[model samples]
Target: MAFIGASRGAAQGRSASALAARLGFRIGLVGLFSGTLLLAALLLFSLQPMFTKRVLPILGGTPAVWSVAMVVFQALLLAGYAYAHALTRWLQPRAALATHVLVLLAGVVFLPVGMAKGFGAPPAEGEALWLIGLFLASIGLPFFALSASAPLLQAWFARSGDARSADPYFLYRASNIGSFAALLAYPLLIEPLLGLDAQARLWSLGYAAMTCAVVACGLRLRNAAPVAAPVEAELTVEASPRRRLAWIGLSAVPSALLVAATAHISTDVAAIPLIWVVPLALYLVSFILAFRPAQPGPDRTGRLLSGLQIAGTGCAFAVVVFKQTPFLLDLGLTLGLLFVNALMAHRAVYALRPPAARLTEFYLCTSFGGMCGGIFAALVAPHLFSGVYEYPLLLAAALLCRPGVTAGGLPAVLREARRSAVPLIGAFLAALLALVARGPQLGIEVLMVCLVLTLAADWRSPARASLVGIAIGVACLALQAAVMAEGGNHRSFFGVHRVYTSPDGQFRLLVHGTTIHGAMRLRDDEGRASTGRPVPATYFAPGGPLSDVFEISRRVNGAIPAVSVVGLGAGSLACHARVGEAWTFYEIDPVVIRLAQDANTFHFLSECAPDARVVQGDARLTLSGRTEQARVLVVDAFSSDAIPIHLLTREALAIDFAHLDAQGLLAFHISNRDFSLSHVLARLAAERDLTLLQRLDPPRQPSVGFAHSPSEVVLMSRDPAVVREAKAMGWRAVTPDLSRRPWSDDYANALEAMRDRWRELLTSAR
Candidate 1:
């Protein structure tokens, strides 16, 4: 009966619709993986960002915090993979399952997700390691257990001997699908529906559900009768080292391509900063295409994919040469290239996959390489190369990649180059483009010369082609960025910030990462400043939440309230000081302070308040250490694309409550294109015992509102009267009660809250 059943299953797979059914199931199963992976990713992705934000106000808004968080995540993933490998090897399946469940239960005990208060403060130079170690102890175990699901499940599927016709790797397609959804859902659904508190609960609930499912899966498999392989499983010992290395290369090539795609897209137009997701999204899609148990045969697709990769590389180089963003074009071409390269790489992996007995080892290499790639791009590259030139050079290298099978006995590059010389020269001739921002004539002339020489050499030899491509990258970097580093530009680990003094000379502007945090007008800073008036700019616009707080402070007597700002971007808020107003800034990045102050762009100290105190470290960390009573406190940390969910929790808000005077107003910038932060604030307001009023007035102009990352702003206060006062001072209440639960230190999952509404949000008004 079992042999007949197996034959039926195998026959079903070979039928026309069998592949479709398998592919469909694989794509949809991704949703489940999305749910499973959420907890770990939340710890790695959300918590790190959250902790960094909580501490950013103190660290001076330095990019280093983000960098450090990445290091932690990569290390933890590596550790998790190692643990999964060990568990599958040593423990019997049931024992492994029991251990995972118990570990997960233990992780929940660390609950109410948050770093210890004041952990954000800059540690003594010698204490950084200890600091990180403590943080890992606090959040690491739960994350580690959760991160192991994919590998653990694969190992189980391998051992169970079920779905003999189905590829264990098809499950990975679903896993990545889950990963992409989490990445997308956090910004779109999770943040807006549930405040950090409720979000945490929802995430915790999902974790519970996943745990149950895992337990159920384990229970079902334990009692199932075992089936024999068709005598094939026993023969599949580990392949030779050469073959293993080939698999690693297959995985690594796509990873390298992903990093290159990230760099290419960034270089084309680093302004709005199209992040790494598009490349990664396509990379995930390749699994969907490549991993079916019985995929349609490779038809002409392999050659097509190879052609597109070469073309994509050439086009990417062209954009760099021409100096045009061609935003949509770049996105389309890069995505196309990513898809093709990923498909080819995945197919190669598919062909190379060992039998079910060795499935775990196969995926171990893949995930390890993924973790390695992330470290390379996020950790190593920043330290290794000062610029993104490695991106294009890598793209050039990707074009040369042929399958290992094709690598042997290919037409000699020398012969091919000699035959194709004319076309190569012509193609190079067209690629020499220079921007009008710099003198177009001299730039174009210089590029034309380089292009001709490059084509000539590329047509003759592959090595020469690679060398010429590197030269072009070097030249492009020099022209686009290298020549003008000291003036107007601030290059830091976070991203580039450009300082341009307004043409009128009335307003000095300060830009950081990608947004303008502060601005100062000459009228406010120069002659009028001595007259004892506070200047308003950026967040302090009359209709903005921060400005509403300042307006409420007008009635309070005595030395104008000492205002503490967490994020100091060009010290634009310094211009808002009143006659005796003492403003202390908690800026995270030293580069930000230097650029804002030394550049003389927005003279917060020199022009507005020279004696203002500037404290450095995470704001909450700094605030947690102090007992100052400010009438108004402003938290505007979500200006970057990176949102730290931990900062918006009920617990953290309660800490804010402690530092505020009875009438103190806390202006939270809830404006975000992706998240409904006002809702998060509302949830926190209720949970932390605070009265909250929210304003949804987006600046008429795109650039006028709160820090740029968030699209809207809200002000929360412990006192309802304080909120009411801010309302009278121009604060608009968009949501009296947004009806979403708050995200807490314990659990949060934005994907569940607003997942349904995201598609519309993407298509709707700004």
Candidate 2:
């Protein structure tokens, strides 16, 4: 009896071992699918900013470059999803796998990716189209291949006959997780650690590894039995027109919001990859959470996030309405709104998802919607509105997606309508009365509060939620109209620029993203428009370091014959052009040139230097074509508070040097609120064995026709006499730190620059 029992126990042990091995094999197969898709996603997303950065210099770092890049990416993504959908729908399982593998191998030919050759100079006109063509020629094929991986592999997994394959949508969450990781890592780790060339090589290696994993996943699928015909047929449910439209609408709002938020935030900050990554990272995180399986419990967490979304939208609206909000607060509120709205929109998409059989179709619709949104925001809105209307429009669209009252028949709808209408009508009347009795400020406040309350009360009803959102958006527009009535508000592909008289009517300022690009004193203490001449204000004030450049240059090198100024903000520096001096302005934006040259808006260029030739294009590109060398070249092409980094790179400097005389003084306006560019300039000076002299001009009292803001200028010259004269004029010798690396076209790091600035601030504070 004992012997028989032992034999039975041993048999049972073998049975358990066999089952364990089978389970492990299934898990490994699923892991291969998930892991390869994740890697593919990482490569796809990280390459976006990487390649865009490479192309930025070509176009002069216009914000539109990023916008156009987004449109291209979305279009490619749609193409990829469509390809996957077609391949799966037409081919047998083994044939589809074979075709996809061939595409992967073909993509390998485009390895060690960087910007393609022959796009050396951007055309003066039709820049957006040129950029699209450039991207298509360069990274298009590899990116399209990578974009197809998620949908194609998921479709393959669904046909593999494993239990996990029954619901392959979970792999999407894994894909976004990889995307989120890549975006975060690019700014924080990859960009800071590796140069663009090194990054490209590393990405190539990653792609090779992902190809191996894809082959493994394909092998596993091949070993498994082909999907039963009945099962495959069962998965082919046609989506109704309504459901497809819902998917597109749900996808469009978040996509538009992403572009708008990035544009809005980066306008106030630098338009570099570090700032660019934050919005995109939040966007990916939203996808990761929205697509993940719902937790087993009451969805209190989701409801809370929904509430936050509404609240954040309200806060963002308030910030826009009241333009005096602090920068940090404004940034936080806008980013918070983006995060919550994206979460809500993506969750809606996830909830409406079809079975694995329709997986590629769903992604195709989503990608199409995304492409449409990108085109509207990046292509249409700039031309459609004088301001950033898309931001508010997208905000309203996001609110419209909120879960709302969708129950009962006509009577039930009428009941819900009545419940919503009473409060809205009452609030509208109250706002009207407030406007008549008090003022626009009080009226707008009342309307905003009412909208917020209505949205909160009817949070579950889409109609009511949309009504509230539209109401708020209309109110905001009215406020903007009122503000623009003062005249001189202009919007372009770069950013918003406003020309407004100061409170005292003593100065007219050209403001861009809360930074004063140019200010002209309009009246004297006697309350009359100054009749003598227009004076250079802000950084170019008469006694500022910028003035010192001309003063010392004229003193040391004799009469200045030619000067080239990059960045033509209100053409304030044009006031510095002496008679007989052939001054040229290299301006990127035509709108800026128009605003600055208009005698009605600003008379600096007209009244001070009417003959100052304006070369309208990216300074780097335009300057490269110039044959005349300048005695002085002023680098002052900052877009609001953001640095045009392409203008400050080593390659750019080489171009500038080629356009300068032997003793030409290169004056860099390094007075930035967020970055210490002195170190960067110092390093560049050292590389050329040039003398670097810097001056932080002392602050002055605010007087009519004079700017009070202190300016920091760095002067680089190979002439010892020029440096000696600058030093005698209170310009201190700028010491280069051997530890700091000079920023090149292939290797600039905004994060490092920001960190150095922070360290300096800390040291100064101590």
Candidate 3:
């Protein structure tokens, strides 16, 4: 009996050992797949900001650069998804693994990513296409490999015979979490801590590690069992065309909104990674939440969707109508609207997601949708609309994605509408008030009422919801028309440029976004439009620092024979030219050049310096190769309130100094509402041991005629005579802070500049 008991115990011990080994192997497989996906996603997202920053200086640092970059990213993502789907569907498991591993090995050759060497400078026209080509040549293969990993690995995991392999869709949540972390880390840690070269090398190391993980996953797949018969049967049930179309629609709206939101905030504020990342980070977060297994129930989902839609509509109305809003509030409202809409749309997509058997095909369709949306926003919209009308138009379209929009069809919509008559009547009354009031504040109030009525009318009826969307769209269109009617709106690859006369009739302004680029004096003391000689008003007004800088140059070096101006804003500074002085203007935007040179618009360029030379393309590229020297080089370029960061770097200063004579002066117009750049210049000057002269010139007088803006000008020169003369004329010698690092082509911190500006403002207020 004792011998029999020992035999039973040994059998039990063998059974337990087998069970423990199986559990350990399963855990190891899960970790391999999950870790591979996480690392690939991290590399994919971090590459965007790093590469875009490298290309930023080639073009001027316009917000459109980031927009175009997003299109390229989406297009490649679609291609990668298609590759994964085709490989999995047509090839056997071993063949597919071999193909992918080969692709990964090829991608390694393009490591330590940067732009291709042969593309010297972006063309003046078709810059979007040029940028796409640049990206394709530089990081195309590596990015393609990274983008494929999420979908391909999930498919592999499904065939691994693990308990969870039947539902590999959960892996998507892991992918997006990595994406979210990457975007957050870029602006907060990577950008602040490392230069572009260092970032590229580190990313390459991570890529190598991810490649090893992928190989391990393939080895595991070799020994795993085939997909279960039930799963294969599920795969044979193909997704219908209508269902695929639904997936496309659900994916496109949020993708388009992501780019639009990025442009909206970055255009007026600053075109830096910090601002660009916010919308993208929120986009990933939406995906994470949408794909989670624990979702709100039917009733709770309805309430959440309704509340977010209402709030988003109101915020959109306020932002589209009103041009000037407080910075923080404007940014907050835009980002909030983005998150609300994206989450709603993504939830709808998640609801319609297919089983894991069709995972790669589902991802392919969604990626195609994303690419289409990006194309519309980045390539089509710039030429299609005079303003950013796509923004409001997309907002209206997103209402179509709301739950139950097609539930009852037209008849049910009619019934719901009849039931909602009271709210509809109230909304109509509010609309009439908005039309009559024509005030921005009252218009927003009316918008909120209409949106509430629209949402509450029939949450499930497309017809009813669309009616409300159209009404709000028309109202927004009319408001935009009113604003544009006052100006000549010109759309360009750079941004929207508006030329108009001020309401006070004292100035003809050149505006971009919300900031006035240049203002030309329209009226003289006698209240008549000044016609004979163009007057340089605004930042370049008489007795201003710009004028003083020119005057001091003349006093020290006698006749100033040649000058070069980097930014051609209405060419107002051309009036500062004396007879026989050769002036050359470098302007990146053709629209601005056309307006400035049109004698009918402003006579500054046409009348003042008709013979001045005009060069097209980015100043960094166009200005760097010049061999001629100038007596004064005025770096006064700006896009709205934000200056191109490339123009403020140490390398840019070297380019400026190279083009200046030994006794010449370097003058920078550093007047900005969002950044404090004088300290940057001071640091650069100290680095080169050059004398720095800075002046904060307030308006000389407030009057009905031409008035000057408070200009902050910084001048750097090695000549003692120029320095002495500048000081005598109210320019102070600024002491540089050695602790603050100066900006360079490889590294810059726009976020720090913003912080310093706000700190200065708060201190002054105190």
Give candidate 3 regions above 4 Å deviation.
Answer: 295-302, 406-466, 524-527, 699-706
Q: Give the per-residue lDDT digits (tens) of candidate 2, residues 224-299.
A: 8577675578565889887888789878888888888888777767878888889989998989888977789887
1-766 in candidate 3: lDDT tens per residue?
8898999999999999999988888998888898889989999999998999898888899999999999999999999999999988899888998999899999998988988879988887899999889999999999999899999999989888899998898888889989989999999999999999999999999999988998889998898877888888887787888779878887888899899889978888778888888899999998988886655556686567656676667566656776656877877877887787788778777777788889999999999989888889988999998888888888877776665653343466566566556665677677668867785446555755666566655544555665566556666776676667767788898898888887677788888887777887778656986778867877888889999988999999999989999999889899999999999999999889988888878788888899999999888788787989999999988888767899988999888888998878899998888898888888999989998899998655544244677889999988888888988999999888899878898889888888889999999899
lDDT of 1 by residue, 1-766 (tens): 9999999988887774877866555444443434454444443444443443333433333344434444555567667777788887788878998988897787787666655554444553423354456568666775676777777776665555454423466566657666665655554555445454565566566666767766765775575435356424543576777666656666765776675565444333221111434565577678777776544787566656655554555566666556456456767877787778678777767777887656666767766666565556655665565555455655554444445332421345444545555644554444444444455435644664555455444532443443444445555655555333433666445544666555444555655433566665554324453224335565555445555557666654334567877677766666667777777876555557777666335555666778788776556667777777776677765434344455666666777778777656677765443445555566667665666676555446545323222235677655556666666765655443545555665445444333423654767646
Where is model 2 poorest over a 10-residue stretch in terms of lDDT?
404-413
Q: Which stretches of candidate 2 lie over 4 Å from their true place?
A: 1-17, 118-120, 228-230, 405-417, 426-443, 453-465, 698-706
How well does candidate 3 match the true structure, expressed as C-alpha RMSD? Answer: 2.8
Q: TM-score of each candidate?
A: 0.66, 0.94, 0.94
> Candidate 1, which ten residues in sequence have the lowest lDDT sum?
267-276
Residue 630's C-alpha lDDT in candidate 3?
Answer: 92
**After TM-score superposition, what is the CA distance of residue 345 in candidate 2 from its true location, in Å?**
1.4
